[model samples]
Target: MNAPITACYPDPGTARPLTGLYLDHALPDRGRHGPFIYANYIASLDGRISVPADTGGQGVPESIANARDWRLFQELAGQADLLLSSGRYLRDLEAGTAQDSLPIGIDDAFSDIRAWRVRHGLAPQPDVAVLSAGLDFAVPRRLLDQGRRVIVITGESVPDSRVQAHERAGTEVIVLPNVARPGGAALVTALQALAYRRIYTVAGPFVLHTLLSANLLDSLFLTTVHRLIGGQPFASLCEGDLLAETGDFQLASMHLDAHGPGGCTQTFSRYDRTPGP
Candidate 1:
């Protein structure tokens, strides 16, 4: 069942009209230039992104069981021109163990969003861009074989054979120079070249850490679940070496849905990067 959004903050004042799934306000315009990157994630109250010690550490399943969170996830997917993900994240979705709906599922739930995209001269579906350093992973065949544009961004460390395999599967490959951190200027330039302006990333902790550290993320959408799963070595929402200094974010909007089926209260918040002094 689709859950109704209980409340939205900073109510869309009378000035800007609300539309479709974007009930609070219209999506921000993506100008002719390229990429505005945002990310969406769900985490537990205790800040764990994954189940205790689970090797594959994809956090969606562990945190996003509530209907409200699921609906918000779909809404965010519908607004993006491109969806960025890590190779392992894509593989988890393909295996059906991610315990979350696919990006394509958004097409069915919110056809109006798709229609809006087409009217604005955008593709019927958002492009999926997967990042992998080694390029040694398998994604759902449907993602490649299906007529959707799938681009693989990898480091030169990946062998030519792997690159050819991805090409054979109908994916475009861009080989960037290997770096200590992958989400830097090169990745942004590549996305700009493709003319992808609004990019949404749904990924695990390591990927988020890289983007956050690089100061490439513009906004963050986070859902905090009521339940807590405590155990050793659980992954948090940002799982990498600690940043040299803290990153600051200002809350842009917040919503609360407390009437969940299992007495769960889910809070969805959008935070924009706080400017440096």
Candidate 2:
């Protein structure tokens, strides 16, 4: 995939093909409420999604990482079924200082996005949850040997012996009742009561500012790596109290992926969360 691309919002230059461009888009229920929630990132141009990495922590700032924005971040994690992540990315994946969780179907340059998730049935690698309210971390046995389904979501003040040590290591902890922290409509109504239609956070920016300060994100998919590096304890995209009024959004599409790094230019936006103001 050499990234043949174009487009400039709604539709302009046309000629697209960033590998199936985020797989059609499966959202409805008004905002895909049943589970069409979405999120994706890769910033810079002053937004700095991360920086200061010498392995002590923080990453993704190699002057706006490249490879055509990781092939649209593995085609948006190959159209997720469930991949919202956090808890400091499982403590930086046991402190090896992890990065690149956008690993789907084990990448052979995304094997045609894992055969488009087996011709659209999905689930050859998506099920991951995680979000942590400090239950601490450690769930990376290569994501349970790729069978997936490691879940863990958190809240309700944790510590029932850390939720029975992640349900005795079978891991499936979800605890968000009465809140102690777990917003964004209680984490998509608890993954829409565990049915998880198409939710996909792949966590960062404090869970995209808790689903855009709780209007419950419909779609985002940013990329913007036009280049810029100011360095100063960075990490952006959203990380606390400010966006409200449903954090309005609107650009339903846009692109420019002239490939990044030295080649520069990599816009790739996709907004869509503005039903009101």
Task: Report per-prediction Cα RMSD to one decimal.
Answer: 3.8, 17.9
Q: Please provide, for model 1 over 169-196, each residue's C-alpha lDDT reduced to its tens digit, 9 standing for 90 to 100.
A: 7789888765533566676667678887
List TM-score per model, in order: 0.83, 0.34
lDDT of 2 by residue, 39-139 (tens): 87889888988887887677778778777777777777777777888888788877777776535847476687778788878878888887788778768
lDDT of 2 at 45: 84
Each model's number of backbone clashes? 0, 0
What lDDT score is found at residue 158 in candidate 2? 79
**Candidate 1 CA-lDDT value:** 0.68
- Pairs that clash in candidate 1: none
**Model 2 whole-model lDDT (C-alpha atoms):** 0.77
Ten contiguous residues minimizing lDDT sum, candidate 1 = 12-21
